[model samples]
Target: MDIIQDLEKRGLIQQTTDEEGLKNHLRNNQVTLYCGFDPTADSLHIGHLVPLIMLKRFQKAGHKPIALVGGGTGMIGDPSGRSTERSLNTTEVVKGYSEALRRQFNKILEVEENENSVVVRNNYEWLGQMTVIDFLRDAGKHFGINYMLAKESVSARIENGISFTEFSYMILQSLDFMKLYEEEDCTLQIGGSDQWGNITAGMELIRRSRENQDEDIKVYGLTVPLITKADGTKFGKTAGGAIWLDPEKTTPYEFYQFWINTDDRDVIKFIKYFTFLDENEIAELEEEVEKRPENRTAQKRLAEEMTKMVHDEQALEQAQKISRALFSGSLKQLSGSDIGQGFKDVPTYETAKEEIGLVDLLVNAKISSSKRQAREDIKNGAIYINGEREQEINYTIGADDRIEDRFTIIRRGKKKYFLIDFQ
Candidate 1:
């Protein structure tokens, strides 16, 4: 199936303008479409995944994609998905973030040496050069005040209060599309459903500016559904924080674990949304899920593909190794690197290189929260060292217990485990 049809079947399309005409245009020619991502943060989160996945899908189906980093728009935050005004990021910060985001995009999309190798563009090139007078006359004149006020991004925020800077966001974004249309001949702008107003504004700007021109342009807009969870909460976030693409912000092991722990209800939906596995293969996996949910084949595939895409093969392997070791009572094999990379977030405590006993270390690491409780748990056969049950309250772990002369794994009960790193 074509990319558009496949996306529709997967329920990716939330809205589109000129659907029939756009499909007709797509049928005749491989269209060039663009999506903009603002660098609101240093790393893109899983919330940004839908548009990106769709971009790759289009690229795979023989259409070109332009990945626009909103280096310019990052200065003017979009109010579409927010209830309050955004704090402006410094120009230097935005520049650094934009560069990092583009570099990360390289991992997700095959954007080189292919028929539809993606093009990366920054809006600051054009937006920064335009004078206020020229911008108002050329681009601003095409938009009406009432129309801008009517937009949900603006209208919904008026009661709570919206900033003038955010109010002009679409005008700047529309200018981006107009510039791309004039310079790159881009005919389609695609984004999340929240972007419909801004996208149509671009189409209107193009039509208003090029009226009665020799080459008539027909720009299109398509939007994908915003991700949500089965329980009606947001996707890609938890009590810990937003799951980040950067391993430093969120470890590869944690990222892989997030996907691996997807609820059974959400796994099939995520497979349809995130993975490129074809319908038949997904169906086969779903059938296997019926027989053996414990195997979690579908969830594992999701974790492997996404982790490998975001990080790399070595990182994914390490993450899997950590996972297996953690789950299968093989903590003895955890090397120092694994302790550092895998248990970076797991609660840890330090001990003097000479005087660390197992029970004392357990209490320090918050395994039992108190020395008395630690002793009780240890005596009751609930405490473990390197995945082996330890009942002795006075079991002092010297340098011999260290994984690589630096760390020891301590377990409380069946599920909770802590890493003790010795200086």
Candidate 2:
């Protein structure tokens, strides 16, 4: 199947303008399509995955994919899919964010020296150079108050007090589409479902701007459904915060675990959504999910693919190793850095390096309520230091017990783990 049909089968399309015409356009020539991503934060989250993947899909399908970083529009935050107005960031912050997003997109999309590689453009290049009079005369003249009000973004925020800055975001995005269309011959724009308004506004801009000219301008807009979970909980959110693409923000282990722990009901859908595995391979995994749900074969593949794609192979290997060691209750093979990366979120405490008995050490680390409970836990074989079962309360934690003399892992039971950092 073609990339367009494949995306539809995966349930990626939510709305599109001129679908048949766009299909024919793709069939005839290598269409240039763009999707704008506002750098609202320093790093893109899991919510941005579909659009990013869509760009890759198009590039692999012998088309030019332009990733528009909204350096200009991001200054005045997008009001789409928001219940309230956004807290605008400074120009400096937005610049930093834009650069950060650019680096990330460089990794995700194959935008290197290849001819069909993706192109990264910042709208601020054109928008920043234009004067207010030029903007009002060229772009603003095309948008009427009634037409702008009708857009879903403006309509929803109209009652809740929308600002002119955000209300004008649609026009800025529309200008982006028009600029790309004029300069790069980019004829298509893709975004999330909420972007239907801005995207159509762009298509309209392209059409109206070229009306007086003899050139035939045909542009299209396509939107993908908002990423959501089957259980109705918000996707890409955890107790800590958003799952950041930056490994420093969210470790590869944590990122892998997020997909690995996908619900049984949602795993199949996510495999189709996230993985490049063909239908036969996915179908076989689906069968595994049915026959051996306990094995979590589908979830494992999903995690592996996602981790390796987002991070490097070395990072994926470390993540898998960490997960395996944790599952098997063995940290002896893992280094200090590996242990720290894997257990970054686990309960941690610090203590001066000294000769300490197992019972006293447990009390010091707060892994036990008191010396009495620590004694009971040790005698009952629940105390484990660096993967070694310490049944005797007299067991002393020495320099040898520490993992590379930096950290020590203490397991109170089969699952309860605590990291004691040595000073």
Candidate 3:
């Protein structure tokens, strides 16, 4: 199947300027397409994965893909999906964010020297150099006030009021599309559903700039659908916060858990939207979901594919080990690193590396209300040390209880866990 058909099967295509023309464009030539990512944060979250993955899909189809980092526009910010004007970042901050995003894109898209390898470009290279007079005369002249106001991005913000800086962002983005088309021979731009107005504006600028030429301009735009959950809540979010792509922001283990906890109602659609699994494989997974929901086979496979893709094989293996150890309550075999990732969010207490009575240690660590409570808890077998039942209130927690001589696992009651850090 063609790239468009594959995207269609995944329910990825939300809007396209000219579907037939784009299909022919891909069929006849190795189309060079581009997708822009704004550096609103230091790291791109799971929210940005659809477009990044779409770029990969194009590259796999023998088409050249360009990952455009919005170094220039990011300083100004886009008003497409916001009710309030964005606070502009300083030049240095935007540059830092731009560089960070460039590195991430390289890793995810696999930058290499080849005919259709992903090319990373920063828009600041051109937009930063263009003077205001030149920008107004060249790109801004094509975009009339009425045309700009009619766009949903601009119209929706009129009631709430938008700054001139953000109001002019569409023109800046159009300049990117025009510049890429003139320099890189790029004929397609793709983004999420919110970017449709901006994408088409770029196409308009390209056509209007070359209106006198007796040639048909073939610039086109496509957008992926906004991901929604079956339960009416947002996707890629939990009570903690947004699911970041950077392992430091959200560890591989945490990332794996996020996918593994995919709601049963949304699991199948998520598998299609996120994973590159073939139709046959996906169909089989669907069968597994229907026949054996208790096994959670589909959820596990989704987590594995996503973890390995974003992190690596080792990271996936570590995440799986942590998951198994947590599920089975057999954490004694876990290394210090495994325990760190698995129990990252649990309560922790740091103390000197010395042997202490179990009741006293519990009271000092605030695990128990007082020495009497600690003794009662130990006597009732409600406290466990290193995953083993420790009912002896006088038991000494020493070198033997520490994992790697750095950390100790303390469990109180059924699921309440605490970490003891030995300094």
Candidates, ranked, TM-score: 3, 2, 1
> Which residue runs does candidate 2 get wrong by more than 4 Å?
none
For residues 1-423, could you state the per-residue lDDT of candidate 3 as single tens digits?
999999999999999999999999999999999999999889999999999999999998999999999999998999998999898889998999999899899988989899999999999999999998999899888989999999999999999999999999999999999999989999999999999999999999999999999987899999999999888888888998999989889999999999999988888888888889999999998999999999999999999999998888999999999999878888888998898888899999999999988888899899999999999999999998888899987899999999999899999999999999999
Model 3 TM-score is 0.98
Stretches of candidate 3 exceeding 4 Å from the true structure: none
lDDT of each: 0.87, 0.90, 0.93
**Candidate 1 lDDT by residue in tens digits, 264-357:** 7788888888888899988988887888999999899989988888889999999999999988989889888877777787788787677677
TM-score winner, 1 or 2? 2
lDDT of 2 by residue, 13-79 (tens): 8887987998888888898999999999999998998899989888888899999999999988899
Q: Could you tell me every candidate's TM-score relative to the true structure?
A: 0.96, 0.98, 0.98
Candidate order, lDDT descending: 3, 2, 1
